[model samples]
Target: MLRIVLLFLALGWNPVAGAAEMGDDGLHKEDWFSITFRDVAEDIVAAKGEGKRLVIIFEQRGCIYCREMHEKLLADPEVRDFIKANFKVVQYNMFGDEEVTDLDGEMLTEKTAARKWGYVFTPTIVFLPEEAPQHVSVRDAAVATMPGAFGKWTFLNMFRWVHEKGYQKDEHFQTYHARVIQEMRAAGRLDAE
Candidate 1:
């Protein structure tokens, strides 16, 4: 029992505790993530119905960046809770054999979809608007895409930015993040980086 606990601690499993469960597909499982039929259009409708933005995350098995994201950013309760409350996240395995229905009505396997979408990274996160354009693929319709892992503040801020529809504003993500960082520092919620 002690050895098991030690091993788990070494693997960064304790902070997330119950949240660290892994699927057979080797992706970390979050109970709040929407499990659907992999239909992009239907997913948009479902997310709208729930008053949440749509997020599609592409991850591959044995991806260290994916593991880091799951173990660190997603594990932090502030980040986890905010994202769960605001986003309807649908996870896709970048190299998997699962069939996905794109918004343009094209049916392709996960790997093919990744190639079609031009996602070359393991942890590419695609954020869709509240209403996607008709007859467009998710890649084309996405308001923003984060291609790699980031620290907790950046990750959480990205989610917040999308939820706030920051893409539609004059301020870019870098500006928004910088402004928020200053605010957080002023409020003493975050220390200097």
Candidate 2:
């Protein structure tokens, strides 16, 4: 138990969270995650129609970090509920063979798309702006990208930052996260938890 807690601490995870569940594909499943045709443009449009932003998460089967993300940050209701309310999430398998259409209208397999996007990590999250420029790849159109799993606070703050369009502001994410943490500490929220 001590070792597990230490591991979570080393990984920057809060250690108080839990998992959603695993699917037959060996990936974690979230009921609210969108099932799309894997077309970036269409997905963006759909998300916009629903008044939400599009977010794509790339994961591979049997990835420990991916499992960590699902089991820890994503499983928490506070984190999960905010994302579900504000964003349209799409899951993509890093090594999958499913067809995916890029924003540039180029069709490729999931594996190829991941390669094209230069995603080198499982659970790489790409957050797209409300308007994606045509003839550009998803990576090029992405407003922000999280390259790997982070702690619950960091993860939730990233989502909040993106939802609030904080990227367009002068305050960077790290700074925003720090400020949020400080506020939480000042309010005694972190201490209560």
Candidate 3:
């Protein structure tokens, strides 16, 4: 256990404060929402034919916030189902050696894609049209890039906000968040196990 503690510290996992959620079926309760985590370029190429947008989440092992969101926040049944149904999910390590083709059709390493795409932090979720450039904003103009693990509500709200084009007028995420919260409450899905 001492070794594990030291490892977590080296990897930078802060102590989590929220209550861990339990699934109704007595499992950790991850949703069926799955994203592809490799060869993003390839996936984008495929999406061009199908006209699908992609949400890529950059995650590193041992990241405290990433663990919190994936383990605590996304453990909720609702969020999982929402993501699985809406996005093409992908998760990748920051310092990995996987190969991915770039938009230019150049073959490069995953690390190169991170640097080229300006992935500066752990748990950075990049939203882009499947065939769009990284700099081309999908729905959120200023913050097409999000860094770090946010609360469950905010994270989940992002999917709906951007998908529905709510960023056109709002300057910040709070308004959209408030609206989503109201909707969630209305549906009585906030406390969904």
Candidate 4:
């Protein structure tokens, strides 16, 4: 028992090792998230130039669901790596005072922008297409919007679907997610539990 305990300690194992870092704004912060001017149009162009899709995530301080997502789903190495490779992520505080320039050329604070975008949840994620329509707000131009927290499989499948431009296909996200789940199960990558 003593030797086993010592071995475990030497391996530096900890279940909570993957917890996300908190920013001064009290929101979860990831290294992969871009530090941008919050100009939606410019950000979209930059993301496309990098061969990445643009993803804007809205989160607030002290949101338990956001914490759950950061720790449980986003913390998974596979998910994190996938997002980093394929997406340019930007974070906005749902109630913050930071200025944001909407795709429609409307300038507003982050809080007002969230309201205009109809994001009432703490962890609303908006995925944008490579080319946004002129004179349209983000709400009108977004290809997909994921509200609130979700399990790992659902979250990962959503990312995959958006990255693949599934919104242009006849198969819906729900169906795509189901198919991915089935494939994962068959591959023994998902636990029955």
- Across 68-145, the per-residue lDDT of candidate 1 in tens digits comes to 888777877888899988899999999988889998999999999999999999799999878756888888999999
Best by lDDT: 4
Candidate 2 residue-wise lDDT, 142-172, digit = tens = 9999999888888889999999999999999
Please report, in order, the local distance difference test score of every candidate based on alpha carbons: 0.88, 0.90, 0.61, 0.91
- Would you give me the overall lDDT of model 4? 0.91
Runs in model 2 deviating more than 4 A are 1-19, 191-193
Where does candidate 3 stray beyond 4 Å?
Answer: 1-37, 45-52, 130-143, 167-172, 182-193
Residues 72-148 of candidate 3: C-alpha lDDT, one tens digit per residue: 66766667667655666555456666676554555566567778677868888876554545533222322356788
Better of 1 and 2 by lDDT: 2
lDDT of each residue in 104-185, candidate 4, tens digit only: 9999999999999999997999999898578999999999999998888888889999999999999999999999888888
Clashing pairs in 4: none
TM-score of each: 0.90, 0.88, 0.65, 0.90
Inter-residue clash pairs, candidate 2: none
Worst lDDT 10-window in candidate 1: 12-21
